[model samples]
Target: MPFQAGLGTGKLAVSKVSASEWRARSHAAEQAGDLNGALEILEEGVAAWPDDAALANSAGNAAMRSRNFDSAIQFFGTAAKLQPRLLEFSLNLAISLSRIARYRDALAVLAPFTKEGFSVARYCSVRALAERGAGNLAEAGAWFEQCLTLDPKHARALHGRARLAMQRGERDAVSRYQQALQVTAGDAELWLGQAQAMAIAGDTAEARKIAELLMQQAPQWLDGLQFLAQLRLAAGEADFTSHYTIAMQRRPQDHNIPAAQCAVLAGLDFNREAAEFARSAREKFPHLERFALLEAVYASAAGENERAQSVWNTISLKNNDERIHLARHQLRRGETDKAAILLDLVLQEDPTSISAWALISVVWRLAGDPREKWLHEQQGLVAFLPLQDAENVLPPAIAQLHRLHDTSAQPLGQSLRGGTQTAALLFDRTEPEFAALRDAIGATIQDYQKALPQSDATNPRICHPVLRYRDVPWHMAGSWSVRLSGGAGDRHASHIHPLGIVSSALYCESPPDAAADLNGDPQAGWLELGRPPPDLGIDLQPITAFPPRPGHLALFPSTLYHGTRPFTQGRRLTVAFDVRPEKEPS
Candidate 1:
């Protein structure tokens, strides 16, 4: 191994004494906590001994730690090629590929290792994830079951099943998580997963308890503190500030907590405090773009548009580039024409910019484009027919849903605070009440799909419809009931479904005051659409407000911003779900 090694930016001498010297030196650097230094040493070693799989594998590990997935992929690929018998090398390569969203590539890498064996459970679970990522949910589910059959206690497989159950709005998610924890009670991640499942299942009180216990067990777990904060916020509790404080105290170096706190305060209209928090975070992590973005958001939320623009200008001018923040501000201010121009520039730079695509839809709508054209261009932007005859059939189902909510339900996902939600995936469950309601929804969806306008390849809504004729395959379904016993109900926040096409809220119960204005707010308890998130510092108004009426369903694009207005009194209950497109038969 006597050779001169090039370290990319420098050179290092390797001794013929042994190849182990380079690895030992790299190990020493890693032990001394100089991870970057270790990476550099490994790089030099790889350069000198190009054919050594061990050196390449070590380099790949270092690159993975550095978050250089592309470099890791290259190194791991080389290692796997050189050592075909080393399953670990192939697994590492596949994992790295998956990290970069190259699911097909990852699947290819793992193809040879998918046979039955003692170590096959990991392969099965990984393949499941890859299939899920590739939008083959059916295949993903099969692989997950395969993994469970091989190793029931497999942590990743169990977590995957739990996540799938959650996505499908299944009540059994909690049990699935509990089963996982039974096998590995000390796993903090498993505990967090259970907490999340509970939160999503509408058990915020229990979720908070679990989070608190997790924090006690792992004092430095920021996610636990964040979960507690989220649960408190969703419950509309007054003392939610302490969780953020505890989180910061646990790890002040983490800028995410401060950044998120600023957004929350801004959303609450605590502009002064939000601004202060943003400034503090900016001072602490001056180099991070996240805080600067937060500063701009705070300025915008405070109605200081000029200040917000100036902040964006400072950032863009310093970096000498066009920034999405500026375009977002334009959209927030209803300057669609300006936003269009800016977003075009953004698209040119990165055509796959989700935010840009999303904003373009809003801009087109605001600019008075036809619904068909705008919806088609936006993709994922469409409305379904409102359900009919719901007054007769819904009451019984509503009663059953409410009973579940009252007796055993938890609060809705932290996003829909102040509401208790049921856990059963309505369509999948066998309850007669749910089945009847599901039938109505399925019929309505079928009618909506049949009425959809014919289109060429250009019309995404028509071309990529999710409607299934023989069956209504909802990606996820659940019910949430918002009952404000003493005070105002908390509104659902503006957000998008990350894994859905058509999102809906079917009104099952509305308080007497739901249709009435509370303190001059006519939109109270109404489903609102098109408002940007408050934390983005843009104070855009809702474009549409669908009045809440029992037996009516408000269906809209999953990509659009939608939420409810907090009502002053009474209970509001609704069933919501995200639908995924069924794959075309081959």
Candidate 2:
């Protein structure tokens, strides 16, 4: 065969080749920076040597590198099946399964190896991930601990345990990440984890220091830059994008820096600044479409709709995310029909998209589509229940929440405006008030579930089989407390919980004005359900409004848009949580 210019060596002749020769050829292609070519060679080799476990494993590796987890799963499954005794092949198969969120399948693949007493850290680590993804956090923790016991310096196990600890609001998370960094000092993720732990613990200064150090170490690292920006924004700093600017200066050719800067600005709700920065970025990187998209989205958010529409017209929509953003732009422009069409297309592609469901619900309501009620206003979909021991729970919970709201400003990407939300998960805290409140909230959730309408197969909310499960129907996915100082313009933005089955707000304390009549003066501080965000230009009124009462809980479908009206004075404190269906064991 003729020699190839890019290939390190001449092409192989069209004849029978050994598995080792095929692997070498694939390695040469990989070394030439042609990952697709390497993957093609490995797939051909797997076909030629179908029973060769090593060839199949090599093909799996190539597919995994290309981010084709589905193909990797098939290849790795074949390898594992061909060589059942080889732990490496089984572990690789488990990894691919985990990548695609087939956690139970991954667990099944690794279960036999555990009985074989392999005692390998990598095996334990992979098992830990599968268990975590399967929603068996305790078992995941045990596996991570076992991995660390076998190899004290195992970075993945250490990182995983630290993350689990953080989720549970344990202070040990900071130390666990620090311990991992002791041996793996150059690990960026460990540093980021440690910084996040510190920030959650109300040590923003220390978190900022770690993030700044990360920026210095890896200038083009977007996560590090975003964390730094978040820390600054939370500190109420006007120059939140300072470090991002420095990062761009440090890495001149890195186009991602400016794009990240725009994202950071927008994510923190600095809409006008995001639009301006994205506009400048678009000019600087004309070939990059992301900047143009950012400019359009943020411009719309900032009420510069004409500029947003102009930018929207220039760019080509690439994916569901872009299509959703364009739909939002259309909604803002009062082109409700166009917006509905786009949202319908998105829903057609991804029926499980919470954002698409939420947006389309708004569109349907505006257009008086009967399907809107079928989707969202189903009987008992929204419930308000009063807590049993309101008097005893309110005071201490309010005080504890006040202490947790130490930051001057709101956290990044949250809907809270003119308020501070607790960084740590509220229910995970050890405070007696929070503990009691959690128990009460759990009881209230049961009551709310009991009041729900009979399960309907076609109903989006009721269609999930997990909701009807016997042993464990639901679990609190996340919980937090938000304390809004009832100053002017202090209110939550209309938003939906994307990853939740049900969402709630349990008031601990509320301003005197909270109970004011909607007809009197601006629905002051009341929970308003089914209102689209004002920026979306949807003039439709809220379907319902619930006045804030201490110990009262409002539970609604997470797909429904909900927020609050601004109050004149005093404080409004509440604990909010998202509920998700418990994963059934395989």
Candidate 3:
């Protein structure tokens, strides 16, 4: 049972008995939740039997469990090469790649399986996930369906279908969830998806039931606890504090948990508790700037401007994130000059920083340099297009958007402000309806590019290091449809599209009175621009507003904060997207 030296080789070799003993001990350690111990044993076994795929795979699995994706990928790649017949090794490799957002690498690993016509359900499901991660939703959906058709009861395939269905809308999502549950009744992820869908569909009672069941059945699953807390916050339930407490207790070591809790509390106007949580998080995770940033943000939100400024000053501006937060704080305090300096420094360090560019535009606007100067500086500000048909009415595609919002798959994300939005990457889908919308948007973007003012060094959009666009070709960053329901029909909150060069809203349906409210503020149920988020303690009013109309497409700078006014009755459906101005090839 001892490791032996290989003949004429410098490597140590292990007898089958020794390898087996190592695996047994590793398995026991893993079962006892000592993943590090398990990995240590596996690594030792791998070193002894350098050519052994099984030992490498064991190490890979342990690393994956520990969320050490880089180590997992290394081990999995070695295992896959050592044992080409073991498709599971390749699958694990692909999954590890995907975990790090190396979607193209994941697809490359899956290529052999598909090229050789390995029609395994697991392979198809994994390939689908890779495609989805690469922003190829149509391909992902097809692969999921292909997997399901190969094996009707494949749990992973069912889960994929359910997830894609959620992007469509509530009814489709419910059907997929029901089908998935029928096959895999105990699947925690499916149950979580169903709960989220229920919440988005305004069936909070059913959502709560499902969430509670998840908590009972899988108490360790953080998604369940987080979902419950989110639902409570969304519904304005009094139990949000309790739910937040439970979530924090469940994952106290996770810095994101506390940071999210603090943001939510501050957003909900629980300033005192949020301030305490931020302070605790900052003290607990001194290395993490996010907690410190949260402390400053909470202080500002609480109208403690002096404290906010003081706390923010203590944060080292080593990264663009810290600089951006400080810049925002300065902007909130009406210190435009200071904010501009910080923002410019951020852009100087990372020229492609979309958020920095967005902020710079805001600073110019607030400085009141001249409407035209700032307007020109903020490239791709606002453009409107009409989706006219043969009869000059809205096209059928625009009309179909409303029905799609009602009947298609529901997205997983629910707006904090009170609306249901589709998946962020929906524009990549090649469905006829989606394709039409994409084409229309693309054509509009071309027009927008042609109409932009000449580039100047002072303009944020023109000053990007990686981009110098003569013809403003653009790439979609994200696209989603939102459906806001009646009774104070949820208005989108004032926020900037931090990641995009341009942002847009194409109205599919407007509440009836939005068009008819001519006597009063006329712009009721309209899109308002320039106001900062309410929680920022910024009192700036909207610079302008655009009334909602069917088939009207409104495009603006992603950095300019924009939102909608509430409508008392009827649903307002719109598609929103973000885009990056692509530099044309030389």
Output the number of the lDDT-best candidate: 2
TM-score of each: 0.67, 0.86, 0.74
In the order shown, what is each candidate's alpha-carbon RMSD?
6.9, 4.3, 6.0
Query: How do these models rank on lDDT, best leading?
Result: 2, 3, 1
- TM-score: model 2 vs. ground truth: 0.86
Model 3 misses residue 489 by how many Å? 8.2
Candidate 1 CA-lDDT value: 0.68
Q: State the local distance difference test value for candidate 3.
A: 0.72
lDDT of 2: 0.82
Better of 2 and 3 by lDDT: 2
Model 2 scores worst on lDDT over the 10 consecutive residues at: 461-470
Query: Of the pair 2 and 3, which is ahead by TM-score?
Result: 2
Clashing pairs in 1: 202-410, 202-411, 203-410
Per-candidate local distance difference test: 0.68, 0.82, 0.72
Error of 3 at 178 (Å): 4.3
Best by TM-score: 2
